[model samples]
Target: MLKLLIAVIFFAILLSLAAGAGFLIRDQSPSTRLLTSLKTRILLTALLMVLLVYGFSQGALGT
Candidate 1:
């Protein structure tokens, strides 16, 4: 369980970093671009949360 949490956290951080890079390169003067960044964050966060929950529940975290 502990390891599962650790892996989940690490994965989340990596995903967040990738999204951050994409966000940084996006347009700087458009509200649509801003929304795109927000959308990416939300999607990644949700994906990580779901993956963590599923992994912990199924005891497949590190397998």
Candidate 2:
């Protein structure tokens, strides 16, 4: 269940990144969209890292 939740969250973050990329390409001049996306991505990456670490420590992931 935890693994599934993690996977879902991870994919959602990836989709957000793709959307951000699309926005960056479509929008022109002084847009906060790109910066917002970058910050979101960074924060999501950190969360993912923490999830992985917790999963491993709990023996929910890895051999």
Candidate 3:
């Protein structure tokens, strides 16, 4: 379950990255879509890091 959550968050980050790229290529004027995607990615990444640290501390990850 925890691993599944980690994978989901990781994939969400990837999706956000793709959205940012699409926004960069499709948007001509200054827009917030890219920025929003960036913020989402950053938050997801932070969540992932926190989950990883928690997993390691709980002996749920690593050897």
Candidate 4:
């Protein structure tokens, strides 16, 4: 379950990245969508890092 959550968050970050790229290509002028996407990706990445650390610390995830 925890692993699934991590994967979902990771995918969300990827999706945000793609969206940002699309926004960059579609919008010639300054846009808020790209900035929002970047912010979302950053937050999701931080969340993923925190979850990974907690999972490892609790022995819920490991090799």
My TM-score estimates for the predictions, one after another, are 0.51, 0.87, 0.97, 0.95
lDDT of 4 by residue, 1-63 (tens): 999999999999989999999999999887799999999999999999999999999999997
Task: Report how far off residue 62 is in candidate 1 (Å).
Answer: 6.9
What are the clashing pairs of model 2? none
Best by TM-score: 3
| Steric clash pairs (candidate 1) | none
- For each candidate in the order shown, give its overall lDDT on alpha carbons: 0.68, 0.87, 0.96, 0.95
Assess the local accuracy of residue 45 in candidate 3 as a C-alpha lDDT between 0 and 100: 100
Candidate 4, TM-score vs. the true structure?
0.95
- With a 3 Å backbone cut-off (N, CA, C), the pairs that clash in candidate 3 are none
Question: In each prediction, how many residue pairs overlap at the backbone (N, C-alpha, C within less than 3 A)?
Answer: 0, 0, 0, 0
Looking at candidate 2, what is the lDDT of residue 22? 93
Off by over 4 Å in 3: none
In terms of lDDT, model 3 sits at: 0.96
Give candidate 3's error at residue 58 in angstroms. Answer: 0.2
Worst 10 residues of 2 by lDDT: 1-10
Rank order (by lDDT, best first): 3, 4, 2, 1
Candidate 3 lDDT, tens digit per residue, 1-63? Answer: 889999999999999999999999999998899999999999999999999999999999889
Clashes by residue pair, model 4: none
